[model samples]
Target: MTNPIVNLFAFLSLLLFVHCDGSDPAIPEDHRFYETMMVDGRARTYLLNLPPDYYKTNEDLPLVIGLHGTGGNAGQFERDYGLTEKANSAGFIVVYPEGIRSNGVLGVRTWNAGRCCDFAMKNNIDDVLFIRTLIDKLVSTFRVDAKRVYVTGMSNGGMMAYRLACEMPEKIAAIAAVSSTMVVASPCHPSRPVPVLHMHSVLDAKVPYNGGKGIGGYYFPPVDSVLGAWSAANGCAVRDEIRNDDDRFKLTEWLNCTDDVMIQYYLTRDGGHAWPGGQRSGNWGDTPSTVINATDLLWEFFKQFEAQ
Candidate 1:
């Protein structure tokens, strides 16, 4: 029989854990109102931007969800990637979601993108559900095209994007991950074929182009392996058609997939763990590549698919 004192202690420990897990710092209200929603009894926050013509037009706009790297936030991602400006010109809504903070702090944030992250993984946060719930809210609150929802991210956020594509293909039409790869050990089984676009640099020191353990002992798959797995999963042609876009960039495509789905890979000869053709903002160690503008390329790639 369980001792009454032990049972009481166990109950108190559970209460403390719940309280600590649910505690989160207040979100700052910059130009973009830091929006929050309760997910799994914890407060999740994201920044939503509508296109300039959104209020005037009745057309359903595409929704792009951007995830940031470890130790990054939604506002920093918006500023660094300059995605909001692109969304304004392209007529789409961009949502930048904040990752779970370490000890409820503002900056030091991380996503539970699988095996190789910090606090989020340690605490076993349900980031997938948080994103799904956020998408549901955005779809209903704004004029979001149910068929054109997309996801993208940098580093850990990029890994999270891959996880989303693997797990939530029904809701996410396509994904464009930068400086990230699939780190989950379990086999990915998407409900439907999901178009994928991967951008990486051969010189990435943080997450190596070849598979290896990275900072914080995070094991990352090689770029080739990730592309190969997705191609097979999407039933694309076994032979990848490759093209040299420029001296520093190579484009590889896996064609003839089920339901017209395609997997694309962009390889930059240089630029280590940085967003290709993005602004250098903070100390995220992202060396912007001049070979191609990632935002333009990803948007072009993403426009080809719509959720079925």
Candidate 2:
């Protein structure tokens, strides 16, 4: 008999997969599926946005893995962040990974970003391993620059980004956490220096810049504590001078790191736990104009590091 799994998966695939039609299509038409695999026995979908010239050339391109926040999916990020558009224009490939969810609940997905995740938090999911497998698949399938692989996430996804940097520092180039802080059982001490950019809103009641009273009713290490741990691991000097932006976001930048790995913090005064400069997704109503696009600012930060 024909495999029922294959048939069901094919139907699901048809519903999820769509071709990119634009002045610059990211993935090649011939390689539309990109690839697929299951994690935790659940159907986790991911979208691979290829650079326009991927099919035309063999030059390796940077790969960016964008993780979505809680109650989010890959498609939402693909449209809201416009990562596909950015990847097509910037000559990089973007991978949008869907988070695994549990029974009966629809659309409420979250990452195993250590502390949060009503389901994943209890299951002890191996998200780091899942990411490693995803990376291995992409590297084998396309001309991905091994040294230029980066991770960025929003909210819970941002926490996952920090986890990756802590556990897989050698594998990633750098990381940017937007409206998310680090969540660790103990503390994350990276073996090697990984550049990090943390952008958060001072007024964020939900994952407050000062820390306690997390969104999911959990406690996490404060922002200052998280930054201090990374600084210690990365061997950054304690900055005496603090810089304040027009938006009331204070930054204490640690300059001149080994191998040019530096740490920059973007603190916005009025913007709440929202992506520093991302579109207000109705969650944080009426964000200010001074709030810069987190994606653009993150791209600027990520460009500073090269695979060493």
Candidate 3:
């Protein structure tokens, strides 16, 4: 007779494979589908949100891709950032792309945003290529305005935004990074000048304002250095203006760049390692600031530019 214990173990292994087959479940009519793609032999997933008017009109609309931070998933980012509601009101499409998970769980995801971070970086995953492919897929599948594609992200995701701006400037019109700095060592050379906005908090302990090694041995360049590099690359002038300065928040703009590409920075007095005016997504260490709504401000900034 055959060994009963061995047969039971084999049956359980088959069950586990079925459970982890990477298929999406049925999504609600109001909610977007959790889509998956095969990139470099790895399965990648992302959530897409279309505006209420998407089906109502044939007009081409702008697309914004939002990247999640390390140890954060696309679902959590979409829920916490509240961009879908904003997209409905503003008439744009929004996408939240999930990063590779180190532990194959929702809470341990990380992007290969260059030299920093965990599994994605160690494995040398080409995240920039993946994002470019995602953009192409969305543009062809939806009524995406080719001249109005933009990107924004939080922490590690923010760093990925900068990487996209550097490598895919022709595709991305602008980028907004919150609580993140450029971690790449070499100078960034974009095909064209791209508008950029950075938001940070003075009290952020994780990615220090001045920059250094952060948690998990991730070395972050100083925020100023990050902005300075972009400014120089974009040929921005010395013209700098401070807007919306108060006890809570200060906005600085570097004007007169090539193609009118403005580089802006927002410094919040508080809100350590958090998206300004966003909900704290449990134990993520994001202390939202009350000074400014990042989604509103970034959308306004993004609307000012189109791909040249």
Question: Could you tell me every candidate's TM-score relative to the true structure?
Answer: 0.88, 0.84, 0.88
**Residue 264 in candidate 2, Cα distance off native in Å:** 0.7
Q: How many steric overlaps are in each model, in order?
A: 0, 3, 0
In model 3, how large is the Cα lDDT of residue 192? 93
lDDT for 162 in candidate 3 is: 92
lDDT for position 63 in model 2: 88
Error of 2 at 123 (Å): 1.0
Steric clash count of candidate 1: 0
Winner by lDDT between candidate 3 and candidate 1: 3
Best by lDDT: 3
Tens-place lDDT per residue, model 2, 5-34, is 876553332111111112112444653443
Which candidate order results from sorting by TM-score in descending order?
Answer: 3, 1, 2
Q: Write the per-residue lDDT of candidate 3 for residues 263-296, one digit (tens) a residue.
A: 9999999787878888886653557888888999
What clash pairs does model 3 have? none
Q: Model 1 segments beyond 4 Å from truth?
A: 1-32, 104-107
User: lDDT (CA) for every model shown?
Assistant: 0.80, 0.72, 0.81
- The TM-score that candidate 1 achieves is 0.88
For model 3, what is the alpha-carbon lDDT of residue 156?
83
| Model 1 agreement with the true structure over 1-308: per-residue lDDT tens digits | 97888755533322211012222334443324568799999988888888778879899999999998876677767766789899989999998898877773433577888774777888999999999999999889889998999999988888899888888888999999998888764788888889998998888767877889765546788989888888888888644788667779889899899989998888898777778888664543556777878899889989999999
